[model samples]
Target chain A: MTNRWGLPHLGYGVGLRTVHYAEILSRWPAVDFFEAITENFLDTGGRPLHILDRVAERYPVVLHGVSLSIGSTDPLDLDYLAKVNRLARRVKARWVTDHLCWTGVAGKNVHDLLPLPYTEGVLAHVARRLRTVMDFLERPVFLENPSTYLQFTQSTMTEPEFLSELCERAGTGLLLDVNNVYVSAVNHGFDPVSYIDALPRGRVVQYHLAGHTDKGTHVLDTHSTRPRDEVWDLYAHAVERLGEAATLYEWDEDIPDFATVHAEALKARGLAAGIHREEVAVA
Target chain B: MPEPLTLDLVERWMQTVLVHPESAEAGIQSSPARALIDPGRVSEVVLASGHLTVAERLGIYQEMYLLRMRDALESDYPNLARHLGPHRFWHFVSDYVEAHPSRSYTLNRLGDHVPAFAATWGKRKERGLISDLSRLELALTRVFDAPEDPPVSPEALARLTPEASTELRLSPVAAFALERVRSASLRLLDSPEREVVPREAVPGSRHVHVLFVRKGGQVSRRTLEGAEGHLLEALTSGIPLGRALTRLGRRHRTTRPCEVESWFREWVEEGVFSAASLDPDP
Candidate 1:
């Protein structure tokens, strides 16, 4: 009974940001949909929402939140969730997603998507919490693998195995971060493609592609550069397995321009198109 | 390795990564092409070694992120930025971010606590002028970003007889509030060019009234006093046109009517309101 995403394919998308706001509106770019940061439009009856309203009229919008902090031991932030949920309905968003990590505890926000150890009890904890949240949202939550710098010595499960289990238990979807795969594989020393193959095809409902920083040993998910060739290969591998979900090209810091980000997104679309054509050829 | 106690190990790992990055070791082998390090031993162990330590590079993120955020606050609130000057403003921001790294995901909501932060920090005399400047700056954006409302327009006003004038309802965009504070605060804000007046006590000055509104999707801020501001506040907040006028007249009977008339007309031109909320006859 689990559907993947807004089907008939949303093609490829880019994180619609303020820098490219003028460009997208002025030209009505060729993107199938724009992924908006839900927090940006929430409580914004202002110009941000003004432009968002116009964009929503033309294209599908997906609401992504950073502060939902659903994993926190703290009681689900009901007020924050309600606000974002209302805005999601406002823009008719496709799906909502947040990281598979805790943001804070004891009512203080630590900001970073800190890692959670892969273990049986922790899986139970996450599954129970996500079930509560998904029930409240009344929709499938797409939990993403974070670009992690560290791991727990106590972890008994491979990251992929743990993720696979969570999807089964919570009945949620996965927004696989290919760049995070490359980043984590390199940072933790593993085969990125192997990690991709381990994911349950049914769970991966979306895909995120972005660039990261390699300042030597650790790779930072800065999303400030073009997606590296290695990450692109991993993305291709993911498409072969996960098929085409809602693929997004994310360029946050040092964002070049609308044209550049759009073109990058086009590359993902081209890849997806290739996948579709290949699927048709086989069919 | 012993299986980490489920929740206990997860919390420990999170605490380790949340505070620092170089913790944990995992099963993956280091591929120069792939790039992730040993996730097992990194617990309290950063991978950056040779050229720059993890501390050094991560320091760059910590510094730049903090500066980038502080720069946003400074740019948005010029008067406050000027008051704090360059070094002192950053000093406070650096300290503040370290004390309270943002919990929220969006950069848009990062500075909501800034005004309150300023009140506490400025009162401590760390970087004075933070509270008012933060408030004024926030007011500007709040006014600009506030939802638009329909108001009683000129045509509606024209139909009102002198008898109806007693209930002169304010337009939605006609919002103004008087915030009195010690010293000559707002005079420094307005000018063809405000000469940088050094921070010092302004002797004998009392409170100053403030104005706030969004015009054409941008915040418009200024100063207003007494009856006019009260008259406008009343009308926009749902008082009828007749009652608002009576309130204004009672408060400012001493002032000449013509001056108040010109002020009201100027606000109308600023895209303040569409028309009053409630009306009759028309």
Candidate 2:
């Protein structure tokens, strides 16, 4: 099913990283879209922004931010939100996204996506803030589930439940990271499939797949390499459940050549195609 | 029987733990964390799941915090990191973050204080060199990301008569920065291979002035000669060309019309001046 806002399913894409800038500008690779980190281009009038303009002109570009701090208790950074809005308009971005997490508090940024408690009070708080963000951008904001290493004991509900209710209250969309679901599942002992199943159907507008390091005891969402087999399996399940959504393959750390990273992202097309075939057979 | 934590309290506690310089155990026992939640009640606040205990899970964040800060700083101050080497650089980053944790949304500004921090750090003798290196590197970074302004074209400069040029006020492009450092720091940066070594202040080390400017999306450095640095500095400070040249003549005895012409031609060619407007009153 298409998202409620009718956001397009822009097929498979990869992050617009600095290492691949020359290749992208010269070759204009066949990736469907490029997700530019909002903060990277927001504060610079440099080569990164220049390349993003060229890439956005050729392909669909979306803004994936890490510093929205949507869940932080501090007053919303209006300056930051204004910059994000300006950037979105500058690039003609299809959508803007940040994590359903906080980065810091007391006027300091830790630069890490800190998970939030899934209590009723927190849900209402985040939903209220999400609405303010959506209104400021004048578009539906998609919040990705962060790959959390720990859970708050005060959480009264599962993460998916909290997210589902949050979308209902805030009119927001979801950028479901299948790998995050798997990582959080193992880290917090929840069912990954059930986590996907719990998300409201029409709210999921995008998918994020990435490689994570398995430390035997727990997992770190390093995004250093290719997705593991289990993550691909989860992506297939999500495709079958949520229908086609814009999928992005993230490889931030030790990223390979453009062909290699694009090839990893292309793997999603095949998995998603297979899921569609099964749906056709059932119909 | 402790009071239930609110979202505000939880964030404060976690941020305190994550940014604490010591171990996660110490972070939990930190005064800031203790002010919100009892140190003994960490497990009660943060759940232990799978094979990892509460402290270990919390440690994941603590470890990643330093790693993230290191990555950000290393990207901005690559030469500084290389000079300090892995061990010393890691410790420097740890102390640096503890002293000045990130307060901005973007990591681009995180290293704004690196040069200042470096000036007072390390051995007293080597501090100046390291600080100068950091200042040079930071200037390059700033120039790379500075606002893009079309450089003044040669045609524009040619359009002005010699008399008109004397009253012209030249504005440097936003993507330009001037750095003055010791000659030894520039030599170290120019060296092919960089490694951590004991650096002592050289006797009678001369100061070097360099200009960093971006042209066509690439940053380039130029070492200033004669009194060009003073003239450029004066012009960029809003002095008209005539006045700046007069000031340069007083500042440097070697200033000559021939040398000034050559410097002006090179500066215009190098895209140093973004715009040149005649001084309205003059």
Candidate 3:
């Protein structure tokens, strides 16, 4: 299903990283789009920004941030929001996204995506903050479901329930990370398929697929290697349900060459195509 | 009864535990985490999932936090990390973050105080060398991310009349840095092949000046001679070319016009100066 905001299905893309900058610019690979980490280019006028500008000129670019801290109790960093808005305007980004988590508290940033309790009070708080963020950016913002290792005992609602209500109340969109759903499911012992089935389909404008590390006791969303077979299976399920969403394959750690990463991203396209064909046949 | 776990309390408690310099177990038992919630009730606060205990789950975040900080600092200070070796560098990262935890949204700013922090660390004799290396690496990191102003071309300077040239004020590009560091630190930076530089190997004396500038999206460094460093410093500080040359002539008895011209040509070619404007009143 197409999102309510009319953001395009940007096809298959990779996270634009420094190690692959030269090859990306010179080869100009046939990837559909590139997701630039917002914080990396926000404070720099150096080669990273220069490379992003050139890539945006040739391919679609989206801004994905790690430090938005949207769920933090601290006052929203207006300066950070303003820079993000300016960057979005500069690159004409297709959409901007951050995780549905807090980074720090009491004026200190741990720089990790800390999970939030899915309680009524927390939901109301995050929804209100998200509204302000969306208004400031002058566009709909997407919040991805992070891979969390622990669950709060006080959480009165499930993550999907909280996200569904958040989307309805805040008028925001969802950047569903299938790998996160899988990792969180394994870590928390929940049905991953049920987690995918619970989200508002029209609000899921993008999908993230990545590899993870299994630590025997728990799975870490390392994004270091190729997406495992289980993650691919989950992606196939999501595409069948969500219907042609923009898909991005992320490989942040031990990242392989551009061709290898792109090949991994293309797997989504293949699976998505097969799903699309089956849906057409049924219709 | 303990205070109810509100969102605020939970966030604070978790952060206190995650960023604690010690283990998550100790963090839970620490005064900070205990103040928010009873340490014994950690299992009640965080659920035990699957095969993982409450402490082990919290330990995941605690372990990853220091690793993240170490990776970021290592990226910013490769030479410093290498000089310290993996074992000592890990300890240094642990100590550094405790003293100056990240308060910024970006990790790029996390190492801003590394040089100052390094000065207070290690043996007194080796402190200067370590601080100098940190300062050098920090300058390179800053120059790499500084604003990219269009550099002034040599042809632009040549087009100006000789009279206007003397009165021209040169501005250094935003992506340029002039650092004064010890010669020992320079040797450490230059020798990338060496995995580790023993503390005793670095001589604590002999200082040198270095220039870091970004050109065509790449950062390059050049060590400066004493007179050339003074002249560039003066020009960048807003002194007109004629006055800066005169000051250089006084400071260095052997300053020559031909040598100054050669330095000017090289600096311009290196894209150090972003713009050259006539000093209106000069």
lDDT of each: 0.68, 0.87, 0.89
What is the lDDT ranking, best to worst? 3, 2, 1
Interface RMSD of each: 4.6, 0.8, 0.8
DockQ-based class of model 3: high
Q: TM-score for all predictions?
A: 0.78, 0.95, 0.95
Residue by residue across A1-283, what tens digits does model 3's lDDT show?
3457977788899999988987987889999999999999999998788899999999999999999898888999999999999999999999999999999999999999999989889999999999999998899899999999999998999999999999999988789999999999999999999998887777788899999999999999999989899999998988887667889999999988999999988888999999988998999
| Count of backbone clashes, every candidate in sequence | 41, 0, 0
Q: Model 1: per-residue lDDT, tens digit, B87-115?
A: 77776675665556565555555566776
Q: Of the candidates numbered 1 and 3, which has the greater lDDT value?
A: 3
User: TM-scores of the first chain across all predictions?
Assistant: 0.95, 0.98, 0.98
Q: What digit string (tens of lDDT, one per residue) describes model 2 on residues A1-283?
A: 3457977788899999988987988888888999999999988998878888888889999999999998999999999999999999999999999999999999999999999989999999999999988898899998999999999898999898999999889978899999999999988888999898888777789999999998998999989989999999999989888778899999999989999999988989988988888889999
lDDT of 1 by residue, A1-283 (tens): 2355443356689898988877988999888788887777776676788899999999998877777665666678877878877887888887888889877665556555666767687789889988987778777777889887656555789899989999989877788999999988877778999999999886777789999998675688889999999988899889988766778889988889898988988998888788779989999
- In the order shown, the candidates' Cα RMSDs to the true structure are 7.6, 3.3, 3.2
- Leading candidate by lDDT: 3
Number of the top candidate by TM-score? 2
The 10-residue segment of model 2 chain A with minimum total lDDT is A1-10
- DockQ scores of the candidates: 0.26, 0.83, 0.81
